[model samples]
Target: MSELPMTVRVDGLPDRVTIYEVGPRDGLQNEKTVVPVEVKAEFVRRLVAAGLPVVEATSFVHPRWVPQLADAAELMTALGEEGRHLPVLVPNERGLDRALELGLEHVAIFGSATETFATKNLNRTFDEQFAMFEPTVARAREAGMDVRAYVSMCFGDPWEGAVPVDQVVTAGTRLLDLGAGQLSLGDTIGVATAGHVRALVAAFGDAGVGTDRLAMHFHDTYGQALANTFSALQAGITTFDASAGGLGGCPYAKSATGNLATEDLVWMLDGLGIEHGVDLGAVVATSTWMAGHLGRPSPSAVVRALAG
Candidate 1:
């Protein structure tokens, strides 16, 4: 295993940043095409080979919700023997049951910070959503698995407009109290500016949530993902979620677009001389291959600019 840098600079930037590769799960979940099980497994394999330390393998949500990732069982079985840090998404107890049955060691649960988004995306109110997930997260932790909770619409929600930072922090606290070891703050609608990003991170810190237990998940709806990531770095956040080729968006959030592209994030990290243990050229090639499978050009500017 490669040893990643751990030094925290005086300016609050990390010597090394951890990239949580979410293309296989979050990225492909929003795709209209049904990616083959073998293809999804291959995508995971290529991402790990390209040196991403953590890759979200698949989501165990019901097929009725996300048909594209319905083959979660088959895909996990294919990669069951691989020794990699692959986290699967488990929406509730049923989803957690499926993941636990597959013997997954790391998992992520999704939630929304705004009440409107929570009701629309999860079909549950704020309290009900946490009530549903508490047992699932606790059970996973009891089984010796690490759980990550994702609080979406952390900055702005299409239905609610601007989400207060305090509201986001409260949701994050609930998730962490549910036995989730880490919380991922998601800009689901991509309305977060660099200033918003900085303020949110600072607010979380002020609420007693350390940057060490937080990750950033951004969308590019307004072309602000990279800039927001820069702000996150300055706030001492070292982990980020990026999608290869920028494949996913929230179907419920109509204004949302694809995620922060892995290639684009890598370009910025490279320019900053940060140590991320990822091979930029290899990631670009993987995204290009996936674009071919999707029958569309990659939405990533870095991929288009480089592959051209």
Candidate 2:
């Protein structure tokens, strides 16, 4: 058998890429069982040490909504004078209040592009969910928090099927107008293809949204996350979201898998000579550690190959 190609040199690649590591929050949020608070903290610590600039620490959502992150407050407190930007997910005003009480300066708000996914995932219509975020975003800004808005199911929705490109662009622009510092387009069900990614970026650009203010969040469900990422990069998007060890699944979408792994992203970036300032080896080690703790093999190919 031919040896697997580790990386490719795509011409005209971006000089630098910003990795927003979401392992702590997104990766661990969907686990069937609750991970120990200390272990979660350690995972964040190791991620920071790996030279990731932005590490999503935890979510401030109510325990009833997500029991896996019930220890959000404690996890935030325990991150301990971090090495990376620690952002937490705030689902609403209450979650924002909790995040403020924890003295968190960076928080993210999530909304959906498709009404079906929004209703199923957040239990509200698209308009209702967007309305709920207005006050939350205002409050976070008032409290001096940097707010990032996640637009889930941007390319396609499992429930609604192929999402209209205009719908995605409208949602993203609305979030930006509502004071989202950055807009992250999420391929929540991992159904996005490279062509879908390019179309989405073009739509956003047509709406006058700067590519620099956008981030791409892809899941590896159909094994298109990395290829979709390449499409985004070609479209002038430098910021991307990833989870270490490929942790996280869409709690609302049953068929979804974890986000793209940080190890794989770093490996790809390094081979492309992209400047991410992340230690690939350390990221691989961290993924291995977390995977072991979860009693499962890592979903990251780079972690498995490099460890061997």
Model 1: lDDT to the true structure: 0.89
- In model 2, which regions exceed 4 Å deviation? 1-9, 83-85
The positional error of residue 277 in candidate 1, measured at the CA in angstroms, is 0.5
- Model 2 worst lDDT window (10 residues): 1-10
- After superposition, the stretches of candidate 1 with alpha carbons farther than 4 Å from their true spots are 1-12
TM-score of each: 0.95, 0.95
* Model 1 alpha-carbon miss at residue 46, Å: 0.4
Candidate 1 versus the native: TM-score? 0.95
Tell me model 2's lDDT, rounded to 2 decimals.
Answer: 0.87
